[model samples]
Target chain A: MLQQYFGELETGLLSAIRGSDGLVNPRKLYSLEVARLGKRLCSGTSPVAWCGITAPFDLLHSMGVTSSFVEFVGALLAVTGVAGAFIDTADQAGYSSDGCSYHRAVMGAASQGLMPEPAFLVGATNPCSGGLAAIECLARHYSRPLTVLHIPQDESGGNVAYLAQQIRVLAGFVTAHTGLPLDRDRLREAIENTNRTRAAMCEMYALAQRVPSPATSKDLSNFGVVLPLFLGSEAAVELACAYRDEFARRCAASPTTKKRETFRLMWIQNRIQFRQDLEKLLENEYKAVIVVDELNDVTWDEIDPEEPFEGLARRSISIPFNGTMERRVEHLQKLAREYRIDGAVSPCNWGCRQGTGARGLIQAGLEEIGVPVLNLEVDCVDDRKYTEGQVRTRVEAFVEMLHGRSSPWN
Target chain B: MAVPPADFIGFACAYTPLPVIAAAGGAPYRVLPMTESPDQAGRMLHDNICPHVKRILDRAIDRDLPELRGMVFVNSCDAMRRLYDAWRRVDGAAPSVLIDLPPTADESAVAFFAGEIERLARTVESWCGRTIDRSKLSKAVEQHNVLCDRVDALTRRVEAGTLEGGWSRLQAALNLAATTPFDAALKHLDGLLGEAPADRRRASDPPIFLFGNVLPDPDAHALFEACGARIVGEDMCTGSRTFTRIDSDSTEDSCRLLAASLLRRPRCARTFDASDPGRMSQDVLDAVKRSGAKGAICHTVKFCDPYLVRLPLVREALQREGYPLLVLEGDCTLRSMGQHRTRIEAFAEMLR
Candidate 1:
C-alpha cells in the first residue's frame, strides 16, 4: 500500500523538485504517509512494531517551526518509542526546529537509555549541533553503526561532497548493520515508483485551478498518505493505480461539500492531521482550499541513479523540509504569491530549526502580498500534543480572516 | 496541594509551557529525560521520524500531566512545534496555547513581541478569567525582575570567582528557577549564590560548550579543571542555562535582557546562528579570542546521531580558523569525566 502511494505521488514529488507543483511541506507529507503506514501496521495481526526517534531534522528544511510543534514532539516521542523499526530523520544535523529546545528535551539522550526499545537505530545529518550530539549518543547506545551524512540546508556543493561521501559510507554501514545491502535495483525501483506517484499527484492537484474542483485537503492528505507505498515495493503499483484514478475522478468533479475557498492557505508542517484538517475546515465551513501545502503534495526529483548518487545528496539538502527555518520561510513567501494564497499555516515541526524560527517574518512577507498568516505550533509526528478543539478553533479563526470576517487571527 | 499560586507564570521553554503552568497555580509535570529510551510517541508515530521529537512525543503520549490548568507551547524548536501539534489532539486534560516568539532580537522582534504579548494576555484573560490588568502584569514582571537580579548576581559571582559551581547545583538551580514561581525559586537560587561550596576554584578550568546533555556525576568541568583550562562558556544543558523573560510592558528592556542572556549562555549549538556553524566560525573564533579561551569542548550522549554530524563540520570550520576544539563524547546521563579528563587536559594544553 505504501509502495503504491509513493508511486502515485512520485510525479508530484518530481514537480516539487522542479519548482512546479508548489511549496513542499515535507513534514506533513511524510507524516500522512507514515501515519497511514503506521495505522495499517498497527492494525496488523501482530503488533505492528516500530522504532525511531520522532524528531524533525529533515522536516525543518522545509516547513519551519509551527505553533503545533510542542504538542507534536511530545506526542510523537511517546508513540515512536513503542513502534518497531522507527527511523527518525528530523533530529539529524540542520534539522532542528530552531536552535535548541526542539519541541521538548535536548542534547543527545538516545544513549542515556532515552529511546525505549528499538532493535535498530538509523541516523542521518547535515551539520546541526543537536543532531550530531543526539545521533552520536544514539549510535553508541544502540550499538549501531551510524549512517552520518552532511545534510546541507542549502544543499551547497561544499556540503554535498561531504554528504555524498558519507552517504556512500553509510550505504555500506547500513548494509552491514541491517545485513540489507543498498540494492541498486531496489533503489532504482523505489525512484521509479515515486515518479509515478508524483505525476499522479500533480495531475490531481492541478485540477484545483478548475472551477469548483473536487480536490480538498483531506483528499490531498489521503493521497499523501500513500508515500511509503510508492517508496516501497511493486505492490504499491496497485495502490498507486487506485490513487491515480481517485484523484483524477475527484479533480473532474465539482466541489463536493467543500465550502467555497475564500483565502487559500499554504500549510507548512511534517504531520498532517493537525494542519491539513485546517484545510478541511476552511473548505467545509469557511469555504477555502489550501491550493499548496508543502506537506501534502510537493514535487521532488528522483534520486539520480548516478554512481555515488549526486542527485540524492542534492535533493536531500535542497528538497524542502521542516528544517532550515530561514530558507523554508523564503520559499513559502514566494509560493504564497505564486499560488495566490491569501494565508498560510506555518506548522512548527518540533525537531528542526527550519520549523521554529520564522513566524513573524513569513507572516509579514505574506501580508505584504495580501496573505494573512497563522503560525500553528505542533509536532509533525507526535500525536499526544494534538488538540482537535484548539487546532480547529485556531484554524477556523484563520479561515474567518480569509473570508474577511475579522482581523487576522492573533 | 502544597504549591503556592501565580497568576501569570513564565517558562524558558519554547514550547509546552508545562513549567509556566506549574508556576501559574498549576503543576508542571516533567517531560522525557535526555537519555536512552524508545520514544513511545514514536511507536504511535510513523517510522522514520526524528528521535529528538520522539523523546518529547513519548512524554505527551504516556504522561497524564493533568495537574495543569493550561500549557503555553513556545515555538522554540521545529520538532517541538510539531510535537505540540500531535499531542494537542489529546486536549481533555487542559488547554494549550502557542506563544510565538520571533527568531531575532531586532526592533521588529520587539514590535512583534509587543503585539503577541497583548494577544496572549487577552487569550490568558479569556482562559484563566483573570483579566490581566497591565498593572498586574507589571507587578508580575517586577517579581520576575527580582528573580532575574538574583540570577544575574549569582552568575556574576561565579565570574568573579566568589563561588564555586557544579553542574548538579546549576541544573537544580535553573530547573527550579524555570519551574518554580518567581517568589519561591528566587530564594532557592539566592541560596546557591551566597556560598562558596568550601571548594576553591581549581587551577585549570575545562572550557566546554556542552551541546545539550550533561552528565549527572563525575563533574566534567571539575575533571577539565584538573586537566588545565578554566571552564569558560559551554553549549551544554546545565551551563549558563540562561534566565530572562519577554513581557509586553517593557518590550525593549525585556528583549535586551533576554537576548543578552541567550547569547551568554554556554550551549554548544550557540554559534551565532542556530544550525549553521561553518558560516559562523569567524564569530566562534572571535568569541573564543575575546574570552581568552583555548578550546571548544563538547560532551555528547551515546547514540546521539545528530550531534556527531556537527562534530565533523565543527572540526572543519573551527580547525581552519586555527582554533582547536576538544570533543568529550559520553553518555550525559552517565559519568564520562574520568575518561575525558585526559582528552580535556591534552586539548587544553594543545590550545596553549
Candidate 2:
C-alpha cells in the first residue's frame, strides 16, 4: 500500500522538477513551490509530511543556498537594533561531526521558511546540528510546534525509541490539529507490511554484497524505507516494491563475477552525483573498483511501525542520517567491511560543509582500516564551481590509488 | 527530577515540561535538564545556523539539564522555532508557553512588549492555578536589585584581593548568578557586601574575560584558576548573560526584559549582522571595559559556527584595541579537559 504512495509521490515530484521553467528568484521560486506543495500535501486527511531534510546530498544538489543564507539573515531579522542572545548555539556543531556548511545553510533557510513547510522540520547528524536547531528556532518564530524523528545507522534499539516517539507524536498532532485520528487498524496493518518491506530491504543489501554486484541507487532508494514507511503512502510502498523488483532483475541480468582489472565502488558525495563524468573516466580509463553508493536511501534503515508510539519518538532522536558523527564514521566502516568493498572516495564538496569537511578525519580513519580513502575536493552539483578536467584528473589519480599504483593523486 | 513514570507521557510532549512552573510554586521541578536525547536539530537545515541555536540542540541531545517546573523560551533566534514547536506539537506535553519580545528599541515595540509580558504573566498565573501577587513580584525584583548592586561592588573586591586580583567578584557573581533566585541572590549579595576580606592577596593575576561558547564544566574556571586569570565576566548563555535581564514594570514589562536581554547579547549569529560583525566586536570590547577585564579569551565549541567563524574577527578587533585575547576550541565534554589544557594555557599566556 505504501509502495503505491511513494510511486505517485516520486513520479509527481520528478515530473514537477522536469516540467518547471526554472526561472524566478531562486529563493522565492523554491519557497513558493515548497509552501504550495506543503499546502497540497497537508490538505489531506492523513498527511505524513515527508519533510525531506536537505542533507549534504540535497545541499550539493541545491548548490549551497538556503540554510547557510539563514544565519546571515538571522542577524538581519533584528534589523532595527542589535538583538541579544544569552549564548548562540547556532549552526550544526552539536549533532553531526562532519561540520558541513550546507546543513547550516538549509537549517537557516528552513527556520526562516525558505523551504517547503515540512509538516515538521528535519535534519541529520552528518551535516550536523544546524538543521535541527534551525527548525527549533523556526517553530518558536512561527508559533508552530515541531515533531522530530532521529535515525540510527546501526539498526539497534537506539533507532527504535526515537522512531516510535515520532510516529506517536505525529499521530496525535495530526489528530489534534487536523482533527483526524490515525486509523489504528490501518496503522497496525501498515506496520505489518512495513516489516515485510523491511525484510525485503535487508535481503536486497545481502544481494548487494555479491561479486560484480550491479545494485543501483534506484534499486536501494528505500534501504531504510524511511520515505515509504514514514512518508510514503500505500503508493510509496508500491513504488518501492516495484523498484526493489527491478533491482533484482538488473542484478540477475549482470552476472559477471570476476574482476577484469576494473573495480566497483560506492560514490558517496552529493555534488559527485552531478559529476558522473568522473565516474566515467575511472571506468573508461584506469579501471578502478568504483560502482554504486550506499549513501542513498535504502542503506539508511526503516522507521518501524510495530514499535509503540513512544518508540517512534526515540527513533526521531537517533535515526540514521539523523545520527551523530561517531555513528556515521562507524556506519561507513561497517558498510565497507560488511560488503568487502575496496577503498572509499570521500569528496569535499565546495561550500558543502557536511560532505566535504569530514574528509580530513574520515580519510585518516578509513586508511587505518585497510581502506585506501582519498579526500577529493570538488563541487558535486554545480558545474561552474569545478572544471571538468580538474575533476577528471583528481578522480583518475584516486582510481590509480585503488589499482595499487604509487601514483600521486593530490 | 525525573518525571515519574505514571505521569510521563513520553515523545510528543517530551520537550515540554511542567517542572519550572512547579518550582515557582511548590519547588520548580525544572525538567529541561533531565533528558539527554541526541540532537539533529540543525542537521536538516543547510549551513546557516547560529552558534546559540546549536547549543540548544546540543543541550537537548547531549546535556542533562536539571529540568525546570516549566522552562521559558526567550525568542532569540530562528533555531528556537522548532524548540517551541516541539513543545506545542508534542501530545500530553506540559502547559507550554513562550515570552514573545521584540529585539529592537522602537517605543511602540517596547509598549507591545510590556503588554506581552503582562499577558504572559497572566498565562503563568493560570498555569499556577492562582494569581501572582503583584507585591511578591515587586519584592522579588527589589531584592534582586539589591543583589545586583552588591555583586557590582564585589567586582572591585576581586581587584583588591588578588595578585592577579579579580577572582573574588566574578566567582561570587557566577555562584550567585547560578544558584540563587532573584530575591535570594540579592539578599545574599547584600549580606556579603561587608564580608571580611581574605588576608592572603596576590597582585600579578591576569584578568581574562571568557566569551563565545558556554563552558559546561568549571574546568575552564579551574584552568583560569591555575593560570592566574580570574574569569571576570562572560556573555555566554550559561554565564552572566542569562542572570542579567531587563528591569521593567508594565503590561509588556517581560517583553521589554526579553528584548533588552536579546539586544544586549554580544555578537552572535542571532544577534549581530553578518555584514556588521563589528557590532559584536565592539560589544565585546565594551563588556571587557564594564567588567574591568584586561584581556579576552574565545572558546569555540566543536561545530559552533558563530563563534568559530567570529573568533578571527574578534581577535582582530581585540588586537586592534591593544587588548590581549586568546582563542581556544573544544567539544563540551567533561573528559576532554586534558586535550584542551595546552591550548588554554597558550591562550592564558597571550592574555598574560
Candidate achieving the largest lDDT: 1
Docking class of 2: incorrect
lDDT of 1 by residue, A211-309 (tens): 344445554543342343334334344444544565556555545533465556666654343223555566777666666666444435544544425
Best by TM-score: 2
Runs of candidate 2 with Cα error greater than 4 angstroms are A1-114, A118-127, A140-143, A148-167, A216-232, A255-261, A268-276, A289-292, A296-330, A349-361, A378-384, A405-410, B1-211, B214-234, B237-303, B306-352
Residue B14's lDDT within candidate 1 is 26
Top DockQ prediction, candidate number: 1
lDDT per residue for candidate 1 within B1-352, as digits (tens), equals 7755544332224222222232223323333234444445533333223444455455445552334455555545343444455555443524656554433333433344444455555555566665555355445556655765776676555544556565434555655665565566877987887675445454455443333443434344555556776655543443433344423345544333333334333334322231222333344455566655556765654424334444545555567766677665563433456776667667777665
lDDT of 2 by residue, B1-352 (tens): 8644121111111111122222224222222211245544444332233333444444444433433334455443232433444343333335545544333333433444454455555666655555555454554444444544565566555545532224434544545444444445556655555576653343466677777644545445566667666566666544444334236465634334544443544435334331222356677888788767778877655545434444444565677888887666654544455576776667666665
List model 2 lDDT by residue over A303-335, tens digit each.
Answer: 445543543344344333433334556666667
Segments of candidate 1 deviating more than 4 angstroms: A1-120, A126-137, A208-213, A222-232, A235-241, A255-260, A272-281, A297-299, A306-308, A322-326, A337-339, A349-352, A377-393, A405-410, B1-352
Error of 1 at A127 (Å): 9.9
Interface root-mean-square deviation for each candidate?
12.9, 14.2
Assess every candidate by TM-score.
0.45, 0.47
